[model samples]
Target: MKTRKLTAADAEAYWELRLLALQDHPDAFSTSYEDAIKQEDPIGRVKGNLESPDAETYGIFKEGKIAGNATLRYETPVKLRHRADLVGVYLAPEIRGKGYGKMLITKMFQAARGRDGIEKINLAVADTNPAARHVYEQAGFKPFGVEEKALKMGDTYISEIHMTLVLEDDK
Candidate 1:
């Protein structure tokens, strides 16, 4: 597997990969497949965020196919600029056992460190996703809190775990 900075031209591939994540591994993400597929020009929307100043995407390709992706989205305004939100993380299960998820977040950490003002990386994962939580912990994130029963699906409740990795932790 290989990692690279994302470009606008990669949007179509990104969109499909996103839908795959939302569809195949709904538990690891906050967005529902129904809400995602309803958007018009999904590819364009992905491209827009990927190009923003406070936003960027990185993809991991396996055998010339997109296998995983992670996005870094910052608070869009100056007042909220001290923080950045890490979102849209997904890795295809067919290639899941390998280290792609760890690799993706490592690359994101490096990318974030290069920026002048980003102080922390924050993300929320479902409480049930131990595998992902392990990956994040290995990548230097520490649990801060949880939003109890934050998500509901068909009478099932899923708590959201909030975690953060301080930039200095990389030292």
Candidate 2:
């Protein structure tokens, strides 16, 4: 498997994988595949990621197909400029056991570190995803709290684990 940053050319594949993820892991993501597919510009959404200015999207490929994606987006407002939101993380189910998840995350850290005022990275994960939680913990993300039953998936409720990785004070 190879890991690289996301480009506009990779959007269609990204869209397909995202749809697969939502279809398979309905409890894992907030967006529904039905809603996403309704977009008139699927690829444009990927292209527009570039306009985020302080954001980046990375992809992992297995045999030349997009198997996963990770992203970092920064808030530009003066008050929130120093914070970065880590989002859009997904890995193909067939390729889950491989080291790609760790690779994707390490790459996210590298990408997040490149921006100014991005003193930390923040993310939320489902409390049930132990593999993901382990990866985040190894990456230095400390749990802040749990939003109990934060996700209402069909007839059941799920909790979300909120965590953050503080960037080293370059001082």
The residue-by-residue lDDT of candidate 2 on 15-128, one tens digit each, is 888898889777677787778888888788778884457788888988999899888988888998888888878898888877778889988888877877678889999877
Model 1 sits at a Cα RMSD from the real structure of: 1.3
Tell me the TM-score of model 1.
0.94
Clashing pairs in 1: none
Off by over 4 Å in 2: 169-171
User: What range of 10 consecutive residues in model 1 has the weakest lDDT sum?
Assistant: 74-83
CA RMSD, predictions in order: 1.3, 2.2
Misplaced by over 4 Å in model 1 are none
lDDT per residue, candidate 1, 133-155, as tens digits? 99998888999999998988889
The all-Cα superposition gives candidate 2 an RMSD in Å to the true structure of 2.2
The model with the greatest TM-score is 1
Relative to the unseen true structure, what is the C-alpha lDDT of residue 118 in candidate 2, on a scale of 0 to 100? 78
